[model samples]
Structure formats: C-alpha cells, structure tokens
Target: MGNANQRTQLSEHIADILGTRDQPACGTSRLAIRKTIACGSMMMLALNPAQVGAVGLGEVELKSRLGQPLDATVPLTLREGESLPKNCVKPAPQNNSLARLSDLRVTAPARIGPGTYSVRISTTNPLHEPMYELSLMVKCPGATLLVRQYVLMLDLPGMPVE
Candidate 1:
C-alpha cells in the first residue's frame, strides 16, 4: 500500500513538473504529459512484478528442511532467467534458499535443513538492493502450517477471551 502511495506521489510529481516546466502551455501538452507518466508508472510496476512480499526491512523469514529447497521470493526478486551467484550458495550450519532464485523453480538450496538456518543473499542487480538476509526456520513441513491454522482458529468468533 505504501508502495502504491509512493508510486502515485512520484507520478504526480512528474506530472506537476512536466506541466509547469518549460513545455508549451497547451491541452495537447497536458495529454502527452499524462500519457507519459502513466506509461512510466506501468513500466515500473511491470518490471517489479516479482516484488510481491519483498518488503525488505532487512531480515526475511523462511522455513525449510534438509534437501528441500529454500524459498527466495521474499527478500529477493530476480529478473527473468536469472540465477544466484555461486557465493550465495553455502554449506550446512548456514544453509539457505537464496540459491534457488534461478532455474530451480524450487530455487533455494541444493542441500539444506536439519534446523533453523539463515544466510544473506547479495545481488549486484540494480533493481534489488546490494544484499539482504533470509532467516530460515527449519521444522517438519506441516508444523508451521498447523501453527498458522491454530492461530487463525484462535482468532475466530469467541475462541478466546481478550
């Protein structure tokens, strides 16, 4: 939502500048400015489509197990057909899913699990910032889902007293 607001503000600012700047003060100019800003906004959004939940306030949380791939869709949004750098893939005791950002479709680690793990993924891509870390919490596959369901149930009608 905040990103939407930011995009709106950016467009408005651009339009305001274009309207007031050295351009001709004519109706045709106004139409062109609006169209330009609109196209720019759309392009920006399209290029960032993979940035769904990637609100990188630093550490992103994930869950995984040994031999299972990590999920990297949170902290990193890669361009189409891009893969993680070699250094991004690490050995156990510090396993991660960031490596899966490429063709794995499963895009995390080739070998991981055992317990909670964390690893930082660095990127030189101008779209994503320099780097960010994923705090991977390891557990039985259904455990997290069960906990989530229990939490949702607790929030149901008259489930508990405040």
Candidate 2:
C-alpha cells in the first residue's frame, strides 16, 4: 500500500512538473507519464510539434565520461544510417527501455576518448523546460556508465524533430 501511494505521488509530481496537474490522465500527459514510468529512472520532456522549430531551446551538454566528470556540449543533430563506432555497441536489453530510446549518436570528443556515445533525451523539468535533462550512456569492455545532465537543446537553424 505504501508503494502504491509513492507511485501515485511520483505520478502526481511528474504531472506537476509537466504542467498537467489538472488534466485527466487519459490525455497526452498520460502518455508522457506512462513513457516515464516505462523508462524506469528515465524522465521525458514533451514539446509540441509546432514548438519543435522554435528558438532558444538551449544547448545540451554531456557533463561526464565513464565515471569522470567533464563539460561537453552534445550535438543534437540526428545521425542516420551509420554503424556504432568501434568499442561502442548496443547495450544489452534491460527491463527499462533506455537502451532502445538511445538512438541518437554523436562522435565523442578527444576528452571523452575514442568511440561514439549513445544519447537519449527526455522532456523533464526536474529543473525547467527548454532546459532539459539528458542521459548519456557509455558501453565498453567490462563496464557501462550512465550520466544525467540538465541542459538546453541547442537553438540551431533547421533542427530536425526527434
């Protein structure tokens, strides 16, 4: 019973963060909530299709590497039809769908070493919108690391919609 209450509270908190506290759970907010819960420790931010091309989304950054910390702006441009870089491959399936959602890949900077990293962006206001939360996952021999960051999606001209 306590666990159930916690889940309810969490859902409510997420709804509030999403600015949908007053709406029924059957709407888009519901889908967002379900997606959040499904991701398990993953959170999402939802942008209206019309708002996709707006200015001021902010620059997203990856602030960690392997377990070390560093600041790097993540490039949000979608990479199409390219294979994963050597030493970085699809992560094993987990109960959470984070792996599946991490379809965006970008080349890692020298500071992060060789190999590309997989990134997943979700709508979240754990801080604020436009300024969002991002998850960076690095998979390598014998170890996997996940890092979270609150960043602004870059305001780029003609940015593609995810």
Candidate 3:
C-alpha cells in the first residue's frame, strides 16, 4: 500500500475539483472521497484475483456478457509451460477419447449485497491432478440490485421506489 498521507493528498487534490463543495467543507469531503475511492479500489482487487493460496499453472479470462474487453492476468505458470497437461493439462482418454473443456457455474453471494450471482467458470485447460488451485474474481459493481438502488438514489434524488 502507498503511504496514507500521499494517497490522501492525491485524493484531496482530485476531490477539490470534482467533489461537492455545497454541503460539507473541503477537508471533510476530501476524507469522504478518499474513503469511498479506497473502498471501491478494494472491491476491485478482491474480485480480480482468483488463485491466492495454491501454486499451479492456470490462466483465467474474465469477460462481460456483451463481449466487451476485460482485464486478463495470466498466471506465471502458464508462460513456463510447466502448467500444461497438469495444471493446464488435460488427461488423454485411455480409449482414444478426446480431452474436452468443461464449464462449471458457481453462484456465490456478491461481496456487496443480496441476490446470488451466477459466475460461469469455464476452462479449456484441465486440472488433471488433485488439488490444482485456481481462483476467479468478479468485480461486478452493479451486480447487486441493492447496489444499483443505492447508486440510483445518489444519482436521482426523490426518484420513486417501489
């Protein structure tokens, strides 16, 4: 982590220009902005990395439903080819059957709120060996209805709620 004072200074500088100056004082708003930005940053980090504990060769790609571009950070194992055929490697069928990619849908509650999120984790590379670890992150800010509602309230004041 960067120095707190340094980050705060940078945040305050940005807030001075972009943040609201009507209700709260600059200093107060600066702190609030910094906290908000920090929280959002943390949320991104938490959902970005999938494999934290295990050592293995695997690559993860995240994509939106619209086929938009998303961030990709391939694990070091993939580059070395050490991960292939074991971490990334699939088992060959005994009777000349082909190795196939499989997809598994894991639904876990969003870190921010209610409603289960459907995350489809697909892999062309197979984890043939036992205990091959891989983690995938979902940094879905508007993934939760509650979060969307909260943001809507901030954006649209006195908006009807049902």
Error of 2 at 91 (Å): 11
Best by lDDT: 2
Residue 40, candidate 2: C-alpha displacement in angstroms: 40
lDDT string, candidate 3, 25-57, tens digits: 757676668877987899988876432222232
Q: Is candidate 2 or candidate 3 better by TM-score?
A: 2
Per-prediction TM-score: 0.22, 0.23, 0.20
Over 1-120, each residue of candidate 1 has an lDDT whose tens digit, in order, gives: 999999988987876655643445686486777878987999987775431221111233433322333333223332334333323322123233332232222234331223212333
At residue 76, give the lDDT of candidate 1: 32
lDDT by residue (tens digit), candidate 2, 10-114 = 999987666567766567676666656866544333321121121111245444322222234543221232223343322233343222223333343222322
Which wins on lDDT, candidate 2 or candidate 3?
Answer: 2
The TM-score, computed over Cα atoms with residue i paired to residue i, of candidate 1 is 0.22
Off by over 4 Å in 2: 1-103, 111-129, 153-162
Model 1 lDDT on a 0 to 1 scale? 0.35
lDDT: the better of candidates 1 and 3 = 1
